[model samples]
Target: LAKTTQPISMDSYEGQEVNITCSHNNIATNDYITWYQQFPSQGPRFIIQGYKTKVTNEVASLFIPADRKSSTLSLPRVSLSDTAVYYCLVGDHGGDTGRRALTFGSGTRLQVQP
Candidate 1:
């Protein structure tokens, strides 16, 4: 298991871009970095993921450097609705392990102002 660290809080205005970076120095070989976004009372939604290099989706883009020790999630033109908590998780989810639950910590609280 890899331990991840991210910002505690971030402030951004509407129509601006926001980028949150996370560091995981002890990532294992089978570990995959994943990002999630959470609103006030809702569960964290999967944003993006990458084993290496870059991966993009409708919501955000994930950028991983060659060292594979860090990752960044970029949210373009963020709106007030985007204000939420962002979490960076590293692990593997699948197979007959029969365990699928997100262990969340104090994630980065992104405040989007109008």
Candidate 2:
């Protein structure tokens, strides 16, 4: 299984933009980069996913370079409520085997202040 790297913690003020970068040196071309955010005891929630280039939704944006070795998760404007643990996951989104699995490593704890 491939692994993703992220900081242990990040701090940001309210109304600030926070960009967290995750590195996956051994990421495969067939794999997709997915991000999930977890708050306190809750389970991780999907933020975004991309294979190449850029993908954006109502929550966040995912940016993958040409090499696919690394990706960035960008949060537009963060608030105190946005404080949570961010996870970078790399895996095959699906396969013809009729099964889909995604594993998330220990997450990056994000702290948002007033």
Candidate 3:
């Protein structure tokens, strides 16, 4: 498991681009960067994922540098409704017997203020 570092909290207004960065200094080669967003009481929702380079989707974009030590989650034109906690998880979600259950560490709390 790769340890991720993220801001404990963040604030933003409506219609703004928000970026949350995560650091994984000891990330492994097979580790994949995956991000999830959590609301007040619901389960975390998958946002984006990438192994290396950049991956884009309708929701967000994941940028992983060559060294794979860190990753960035970019939200374009964020709104107040997007306020939630973003979690960065790194692990091999493949069919590895002991790797199936990855622990959920801390997550980045994002507050989109009106």
| Full-model lDDT, candidate 2 | 0.89
List clashing residue pairs in candidate 1. Answer: none
Query: What order do you get sorting by TM-score, best first?
Result: 2, 3, 1
Per-candidate TM equals: 0.90, 0.94, 0.93
Tens digits of per-residue lDDT, candidate 3, 1-114, equal 778888898899989999999999999878889999999999999999899999999999999999999999999999888999999999986665654756577898899988
Query: What is the TM-score of candidate 3?
Result: 0.93
Candidate number that wins on TM-score, 1 or 3: 3
Q: What tens digits encode model 1's per-residue C-alpha lDDT throughout 1-114?
A: 678899999999999989999999997777789898888888888888889999999999999998889999999999999999999998866447847665566889999999
Assess the local accuracy of residue 60 in candidate 2 as a C-alpha lDDT between 0 and 100.
Answer: 94
Error at 86, model 1, angstroms: 0.6
**RMSD to the hidden true structure, all candidates:** 1.7, 1.1, 1.4
Estimate every model's Cα lDDT from 0 to 1: 0.88, 0.89, 0.90
Q: What is the lDDT of residue 49 in candidate 1?
A: 83
Position 113, candidate 3: lDDT = 82
**Model 2, C-alpha of 36: deviation from truth (Å):** 0.6
In angstroms, the error of model 1 at 114 is: 1.3
